[model samples]
Target: MGIVDSKGHLYLKEDPEVWIKNNPASRLALVTSFRLNLENGVEEIAESIGELTHLIHLVFRWCRSLKRVPNAITRLHKLEHLLFHSCSRLEELPANIGNLVSLTHLQLSHCEDIKFLPNSIVNLSKLTSLTLCHCVSLVELPANIGQLASLTHLKLSSCRNIKSLLMSVANLPNLTSLSLSSLSLSEIPYNLGDLKKSLTRLDLSYCNNIEFLPNNIANLSNLTSLSLICCNSLIELPSNLGQLKSLSYLELYYCNKIKSLPDSIKDLCSLDTLIINCCDSLTHLPINLNVLHLKLLNFCPRFLPNGLINLKYLRVNICSCSDESFVNWKDPYSLQHLAISSCFSHCNYILKVPASLNQFVNLQVLSLHYKKRFVELPANLVGLAHLCLLDIQHSSISCLPWSITKLRRLRHLMLPKDFRLETLSYELNISVIISVNERHVRKTWEELKTEIGQLPIPFGGEITNDAAQNPSIMSHPGYLWLKENPSQWIINNRNLLKLVRFLDLEYVELTDSIMQFSELTHLCLDIAADICLPDNYFVTFTRLTHLSLHFFSVGKHKSITHSLSKLSNLQTLHLHMHHSVLLANFNMPVSLKYLSLSYCNNMRPLYDSLEKLTNLKTLDLYSCV
Candidate 1:
């Protein structure tokens, strides 16, 4: 069955004839939008579709057998949007499609058989957007396309047969955004500059044959963004590019042929974000460019600007540069996010933190990734009071300075996955760990039994006597039983506990102490033992939106499903369990939007449970049998 909204919008996945036969013609006249999707056997729409005079939007998606659009569709003069995607067998559009004088948007994607648009398409004077992507057979556009005076956006991607665009495109005086790619042209149309007064964004990504841009491109004074990603053959840019006074963003990724940027780039006072990554042939960067956000990967410059007062975000990766290149900043107080990483496994260079790091008072997010050379952080980090996120994963740093406890605003702390529980407990000064071995298991178990009696019963019931008596179960290396009373440091840093929002742990025993993070919105646990969660644990996390659990061994945890279903606010859930764990009766929250299950066998029993997740938009099953 299809759905009809209160505003007279109809969405149908089945044949429309079945619906029309059940409804009155008068009711159909009120429908302003109609969408038909996944009706794979549908070849043609009924000409009676023209009777819906109020129709404003029409879409046909994944109708693979559809070959043509009826000319009767043009009779709906009020139609403003027409879209067809993944209709691979679609051969052509109606020749008189322009008869819908009110059409403002049109898109056709993955329709491989489409070759050229009808010349009458120029009659759609009200059209504002036209997109034809992944139409491999499309060769040329109408020569008079500029007649669409209201057109503001045009995107033509993956149209490999389109060797060049007609010069008339420059006549679109109101066009503000233009994207072109996957073409054989070595240069853009010379007249493209004619639209300088209105063009604000230009993207030529994946245009592999383009070598150099015309100097007249500098005439686009109002342009705000320019992207040349993966344009491998491009060697140089227009020398007068700095003339674009309003330009704010520029990206040149994978353009390996470009060796250097124009010196005039320093004149771009309004530019704020610049990204030049993977440009292996690049040797140097212009000094003192006034940008607020900058990223440089795999390309190291000999020198950096002395003072970038407005810079707020900076990321440099895989660059082999001297420590001087980073500490040279004179006034870096405005920076809010900084990340530096060394990803090259064989690179011997060691990246060191700048000695003047305290100058960045406004910094909030810091991430550092290094395989082995990076060992420690500065002793005093209290200078960064506003710091909220600190990620040092994949680094050799084993311990953190005790002064880290002063970061009251620190909410997200990501450590290396292999970090030991004892080290974390000692650094945080929060827990008293208890170790149990085969010889002393009985003594420790008797003492813990009295302590467990006072605590709330855990989900999936308490540990059984037989299981507790087993030597293999009691002596598991990952287990770490803690006392109920917290250390004095935990009492003094109560605010930090309340503000923490994300935690990622491995082999850490689940205990009542975790419930203190009342504001946590994300939690990830990598469990190596057969443990049960505390009672009402998920119920207390009303704000948690993402949860991931990786179970390493199979255990008797029948309440796992009931425990997960209690999380009403969870939006994303990831479960990576051993193949032996039975997935029968597994139910997830209805609010979940993304679910990923990996390495779990016998997933057929979960089909019934998944059918109830109406809001789920993405489901990923990896290595599931």
Candidate 2:
């Protein structure tokens, strides 16, 4: 009954009964869903699809060679979902596709050659979601697009040729979410305010030509989130924007022409988060801007205004202008996360953080990004006892405050790449992680234990050996086991360590206990000095395919090199020693398929040793000075 390959041809003589195997009595009854995966040489599906009388869903995703959808598909009276995702060669849909009155979802993402949609598409009364993302050649939508009365979400992002939308779109009564990112739209219909009753989210990011929002946009009382990122031509927001009572999030990044915000913004009582970045012309903010109980806010302006009394998360980038107004720490204490970035491009200066920072008794995370500023942190940090994460980078500070050792609740300490502090109080046994990027960081085993503690386990919220039966136990990068001070929960569940596949260690000594992790495949080590590994260190690491070594000295060169040679299954190796005098020679396993030696300044090309790695497919030697 299953047709595997047709080679762009259809055989109508095949019995329809083969497609349905459950019953001989219903041989002619078409199934509710028909999913076809065309073979390598199959380029087309013939018009026989019309014979599927009961078909409600037809999905042909990953059919890269398909050039067109058969017009006969319109014959399906019950078809509700038709997806052609990644049909790269598809040029167009049938002009009369709207005949499928029952269709509710249609996705044609990544159809590179599609240029237009049939105007009749607006006739699909029940259509709820329409996605045409990354359709490079799509120039526009039908002028009567608002006729899709039931449409709730319409995504036309990455359709670069779309210059404008028809004003009729404003008439859709049920549209809730619309994304027009990465388009050439110059302006949206002023009547978009008509959707105020139902529209909740609107994204117009990367619409570079948009100059201004319609003043009538304030009528969207139900709107919650709005994004206008990278709209370079945007100059200002509607004066009555504060009238949107339900608005929770408003993001406007890189809109350089905006100069000021309306003082009426204080009327937005429900506003919880607002982000405005890279608006070079912006000099000031509303006088009473902080009246709302905002949970998260990211703003960059010359002079910051005062009343932020209830912020839980805040990121402030100070422009060239000096910091004048001091922050107001809410009395009932709600602030938890705070980050400050200096935007002084012309010169390096020391920024003085107000001592009032200690007022946030409930503060948890504090991050600082200084281009060239030496910020004098608060002398007394014991008041911020709840703080857990402290991140500092690209700053010129002489040393960390001695009070840092007193923060017992602190779990993660991220320092700059060139950070020089070598010792820390062993009593403050938190994990010292090196920030790698936004998504991933270098974490130590002790930090890894904290990560495991955060997981939601079933038995008393502890990760027990029997807890492994629950599939969600080891679902995330942070939900892994490591050798830290063995808690009673871990002591009762020694087998739980076998579930860990990734291990990141900082300044940890190599020991024989590591070989017990039979499933560990990824390992990262940050060594400050020498490490002598056991003779058969990697013999049991048969599954370890990725190894990263960030060393500061060549003291363990022979020991480390000998240990690496035993990793016979290792296919990827990353060396991140930046100092010049480190080991210039390496004896790597021939099984390595990817090798990266970044920031090894004095490393010279070893042609002979490299030639021995015949299986290597990628070699990155970035910044080898």
For candidate 2, lDDT tens digit of each residue in 1-625? Answer: 2532333212222223344343342433535666765644556666766777677777876777877777888999898998987878888889999999899999988989898899889889999999988999988888789889999998888998888888888888899998889898888888989998999999999999999888888999899999988899988888898998998888778888888877778778777887877666776777555433331222443355656565677676543443442343224277788777665352365665555667778889888776457434665677778888887765544235546767778877776543322222233445554343321336663543332222112223334224654322322322332324223333555666665555555565555666555667766666656565555456577877777777866454555655776788787777777564434455778887777675665454445478788788766665666
Error of 1 at 305 (Å): 3.7
Candidate 1 error regions (>4 Å): 13-22, 38-42, 301-303, 318-325, 329-333, 344-362, 369-388, 393-398, 403-625
Alpha carbon lDDT at 129, candidate 1: 98
Best by lDDT: 1
Query: How many residue pairs clash in all the candidates, one count each?
Result: 0, 1
Residue 430 of model 2: what lDDT? Answer: 55
Question: How large an RMSD does model 2 have?
Answer: 16.0
Estimate the TM-score of every prediction.
0.66, 0.61
Worst 10 residues of 2 by lDDT: 451-460
Q: How does each model score on lDDT?
A: 0.72, 0.67
